[model samples]
Target: MRTIDECRAEVFRRSEEKIKARRRARVRAAALCVPLCLCAVIMSVAFMLPKGPRTEEDMMQEDGEAPGGASGTEFSNDLVGDGRDDDVNAPGGEGSLSVSFSLTWGTYGISSYDSATGRLVKATDATRPEDYVTTYRLTDEETELISELIRGLDIDRYPDVYDPQAGKLGSDPSMTLILSVRMGAKEKTVTAKNIALTYESEDPDGQLFLDVCREIVEILTGTEAWQSLPEYEFFYE
Candidate 1:
């Protein structure tokens, strides 16, 4: 049903559309190259182009010189673990002592020591350095013994060490250790209950405080003071 002239006209129309599409593609390609052209100009102005590959021989002459060479920080990867020093049973000594009493009566456990001959007492009942008050709380006998320990501790060295509630015991205000790390010259105080907790905490780089108390306990309670000691350990079980 078609003639040669009509077919020829349709062919000419398709050719025109293809030519327009090719021109549009060329225009888009030129647009895309515009930014590339700008970047090329920037690089050209920034640095001189290299003439050729520079081998080791070309770099050999400049080994000793640099533009602004400066030293960089270096670190060692050799460090391991958290401990800085690990040595026990060395020069440092340790000790601890505990006495049971009541805070309601305003009396707390007392201990005394003298390094001169290395003597320690619980109370001074008969003005004897060896004998100490056994029952009465803060009696003249106990006060004398406590005073001696206070003097030995170097009041000038341990201020603000005692706590206000140190010798405290039962909630009844009668049973307490009364160890107040505050007051006095170089004094640190703690109740018998707290003494146990402090030694257990043994914090800050290792038991330094525990060591000091251990020495004091050795003086006051003798070598076997803790042979039959009792402590509560489990909270849930």
Candidate 2:
């Protein structure tokens, strides 16, 4: 029943088993499409790369510089959200006044003034206030009580100038206060942090900036080079 040369050798053995089952189904579809096309080319080169570091809110959205430039929180949205200064209450006295304090058990203080040397500089030093120098002049009732306590504080309503852990406590000691003023060419500065449990918290505007930094640290420790360093005290309470 079969023989025409075994029916052409059973039609060339069923065309060589259908060409080796189509070359083993194209080598199992190229080994399953080359690892899924190399995992989609390594996820398209990891989403076209480029991104790592630059936070601090991306440097305040790239160049509105906060985080410690001009002592941080860079200024002027009409001097902190329209709290208004009207050019620091314009008047005749043209510029210059500074105040500083630094601590963490080393205390470095400074107070300055200048209406072309009308004089009022109470400098202080640390390592337990063991260094000093003082000066005074300007008597128009102490230059109108140091220009009405530096224009009655309200430092642009202080909403966080540099809160490096807002007035931390229990690190043995800590404190920092700095205020600056210069009317003519316009300069303004404010920094505070007198962490004694940040004034035992109850924030009424951070206890009115710790009660105007304890009346400017009692007017720079009531000068006379802090009363000739009488056992130098004022260890930030």
Candidate 3:
């Protein structure tokens, strides 16, 4: 009973209804995502907020004042730590085994190496010090180095111990050793000595020395081989 024009209009109306329904569904889907997006934004903001910086209120409280006040800090240093600082026992004396060591390079300078990290590094303490505290890369190592010195030897196989009154065996080689060790200490003064071991060899053994020293430092100080001064105790300049 309807005209062709009327039928075409009905078809177009149906199409319009379908389009509207689709748009409504899309709006609902997008609405579902809003809460999740909002939650993510809130979490991001919370994570980025600064945590360590002191607030104005905190600062005021710390300064012992309100509003604007001069900031203050309280800190203290241990003039003396543990009994270790009070005594410096000699190397061989009874109940006196705490010792620090030093190496004298003169122009050659000291070198250090680290076995823990397998990293061999060098120290630029090229300028020698009047008094420096050093350690053996290893206690066993120190024993070896010291024993070797006592025997008058070098890194390479060379025997240089002198007989004093007797004639010296081999000629002087390339370099010399400057070994100074603090064996023990008293209430006021500590006991230390220096031993110079000359070598009949040449060539800068910086890298070799560094590796050896690093090991020694590790043994004596529980660190690496180069000794600066008193890493732990109180001492005079």
Candidate 4:
């Protein structure tokens, strides 16, 4: 019973309602997707960003602190060098310097030099200073040379122990070397186990430690008293 105009007007109103409903659905969908897309983009950007360089504190935490509570600042190959010099008598005034080197494996031995006593003692098959196989007095020049070498070395930069990958080398027959140096009241001792292997393995820290040990050993073995001592009876593989 409705007129044609009324029928047409009703159709137009129904079409407008359908269009508004579709527009509301699209707005709701867009509102839901906008935050999700932003979150995804933020996460991707964060993941793609590069990390910053490691600081000295990070390295110190990883490698641990050096002997005498020293920081790990100058622990590099440039600081540690092979102990060889054309001029053994480098000019340096003498002070209260004491150095000792001990090697242990199949046999035990220790070599010690003291500037106060002007005595160098080398003992084998014994640990005490009283049991010395060879003893010699160091001249003023000899003491100065030793003092120069010991003072030149920054022993505080070295760790107390140098053993690379300790868990893997447990079964192997390793030789332990202990070097102790005292300048005035300050003293530091460094112990290395199988340092040759560590040197060969190319560990930077271990290599530096080995170099310091070599410097001390060179100072000890290069002496006339050390050269006069007899060879070892037992050998270690």
lDDT of each: 0.33, 0.44, 0.35, 0.47
Question: TM-score of every model?
Answer: 0.23, 0.22, 0.21, 0.42
Distance from true location, Cα of 125 in model 3, Å: 7.2
Q: Better model by lDDT, 3 or 4?
A: 4
Q: CA shift at 64, candidate 3, in angstroms?
A: 53
Best by TM-score: 4
Which tens-of-lDDT digit does each residue in 1-237 have in candidate 2? 987999999999999998897566444434543453354445444543437866788667647545454543322322221222333333434322322122111223343434334344444544442243344444344444444444344344454353424544423355555555444344456655444533333544454445444444455456564455445434544
Candidate 3: clashing residue pairs, number: 25
* Candidate 4 wrong stretches, greater than 4 Å: 1-123, 126-132, 137-152, 164-172, 197-201
Q: Model 3, range 29-50, lDDT digits (tens) per residue?
A: 3453344335444544555456
lDDT of 3: 0.35
**Model 3 RMSD vs true structure:** 33.9
Could you give candidate 1's per-residue lDDT for residues 42-114 as a string of tens digits? 5444433457898787687445345333422111111110111121111222221112111210122334433
In model 1, where is the ten-residue run with the lowest total lDDT? Answer: 75-84
Candidates 2 and 3 compared: the better one by TM-score is: 2
lDDT of 4 at 218: 53
Ranking under TM-score, best-scoring first? 4, 1, 2, 3
